[model samples]
Structure formats: structure tokens, C-alpha cells
Target: MTPYLNLVGRDGIVVLIGAIDMVPRFHSGNLLMRRRSLSASMIGGIVETQELLDFCAHHGILPECELIAMADINEGFGRMERNDAKYRFVIDMATLERK
Candidate 1:
């Protein structure tokens, strides 16, 4: 998670949600994969979708270029809802480039 946060803070690397599973079921013979969770939160503000889009554009980053990966869970559902509803602040790393 620290690595992900640091990467997001960097100048070139871009991070975005790629995939999501609403209901995941493993087969009897399937093996469970290990994963780590990394998420950040903001306290206030009604972040608009257009503001996020414009921010990404100003930073030379495309939201479509990034990918988010998630599994089937309540947290995942919440994230999907937040993203689809465009309720969080988005930071574009591409804007940190040298002028």
C-alpha cells in the first residue's frame, strides 16, 4: 500500500482502477490468491466529475489509461459506487512533470 501511494505521488506513474468482481466464487480445486489492500480517504467536499476529468486532462493523464482491480466484496461495491458516482478527489500524476 505504501508503494502504491508513493507511486501515485511520483511524476510519471499513473494509477487507476482496472477490474472489479461483484461476486467471486472459487472452485473446490481452486487456490486462493493473496492480495494487499491500499486505499486513501478525504474528509470533505463535493467533488464533481467534470473537475476530475479536467484535472486528469491538465495533467496529461487519461482516466481510461489507468486500471483498477478489485474483488467481490462490500468494500469493492462501495468503491465501484464512489467511482461510478464520481464522488472522490482524483490526483493526476502526469501534471507533476517538469516545466
Candidate 2:
């Protein structure tokens, strides 16, 4: 989380989603100097999650993503680092059975 502080642009916000057990430690200067903010949100309960999933399914809504084989995970990381991959990467676990 500390590493992410330096990554955001000035006046940027880092929103943490879901549970984080580890106590985060970072310098106040990191936020003060850049006008950054650290915020969090709960994803919601299982029932609410299920309802959202059902709504999307009913509406035929889909997320934009790229499906990659497990073997190409390193390449996927590289793409992400280079900002080449524009969408989320979903690993096709079936590829693991190939070799």
C-alpha cells in the first residue's frame, strides 16, 4: 500500500476495496506533499453481491477484459507494467492442463 502512494498523480486518490488485515504504515508527508488521499470501501454483503451479479446477468452486461493462459502470466504482468494491456486479465485455468 505504501508503494502505491508514490504511484498516484498529484491530488490523486487511492481507494482500497475489500478487507485488509495488515496495518498500513506510511509517511504523512507522502499525502501532504501530493494532496493524495487514502480511502476504503466495503464490497458489501454476499446477498448484495449476488443481487448485483444477477442484475448484470439479467441485463447481459459484461466486463471488458482479456483472457490469457496461466503460462502467459509473466507476459501479462509485463503488459500491465508497460501500460499496453488496456483491460483486466482473466486467467484461463484450463490452460494449466495443457503442459
Candidate 3:
């Protein structure tokens, strides 16, 4: 979140986030001033979609991500705020069970 300040401060960069629950603060004026939008989107169950996962497997496509335990969600959110996390957040229950 802090990293976004530089881009949104005066660079007119759109801040696209899926969630803001972990972000501590924000300046709406700064976003509006640059004709930029802080957009939040709901990517409904894309990871759970079997078709998509199969497509990825078929094409050998996978995101560069780190898998963390569900217990580490708080830490995950912290990393997210710092932009340290790449793509993956929490590990699914099925994946956890296998381990």
C-alpha cells in the first residue's frame, strides 16, 4: 500500500487492488486529482475453476507465487501491503490436507 503512494501521488497510475482490508490508509483526493481510479474487482473463484486449472496444466501455465498456510493469513496481508507477495495468498484446504 505504501508503495502505491509513489505511483498514485502524482504519476496518475491506476491502483488496481482486489482487496483493501489490510491497507491502513488512503488519500482519495490524490487518486481523483490524477484522473485515476482505485479499482477493486471480484475475480470469482478463478482458482477453483477446474476448466481454468486444466487449461493451465495443459499449457504448462502457472503463476509465480508463494503458498502460505491459512494460519498465516495475517502475515500474508502484511506482506500484501508491502507488495512482497507475488500472486498466491493462502493455500486451499485440499492442498493443506494433502500435506
How many pairs of residues in model 2 come into backbone collision? 0
**Model 2 spans with C-alpha error above 4 angstroms:** 8-13, 18-39
- Per-residue CA lDDT of model 2 for 61-86, tens digit only, reads 99999999988999999998786887
> Candidate 3 has which clashing residue pairs, if any?
none
Candidates, ranked, TM-score: 2, 3, 1
Which ten-residue region of model 2 has the weakest summed lDDT? 90-99
**Which has the better lDDT: candidate 1, or candidate 2?**
2
Clashes of 1: 6
lDDT for position 52 in model 2: 94
Tens-place lDDT per residue, model 3, 39-83, is 555544756677778989999998877777767778889987786
Q: lDDT score of model 1? A: 0.40
lDDT of 1 at 75: 55
Evaluation by TM-score, superior candidate among 1 and 2:
2
lDDT of each: 0.40, 0.89, 0.65
Q: Model 1, 28: alpha-carbon shift in Å?
A: 20
Top candidate, metric lDDT: 2
Query: Where is model 3 more than 4 Å wrong at Cα?
Result: 1-54, 94-99
Instruction: Rank by lDDT, highest first.
Output: 2, 3, 1
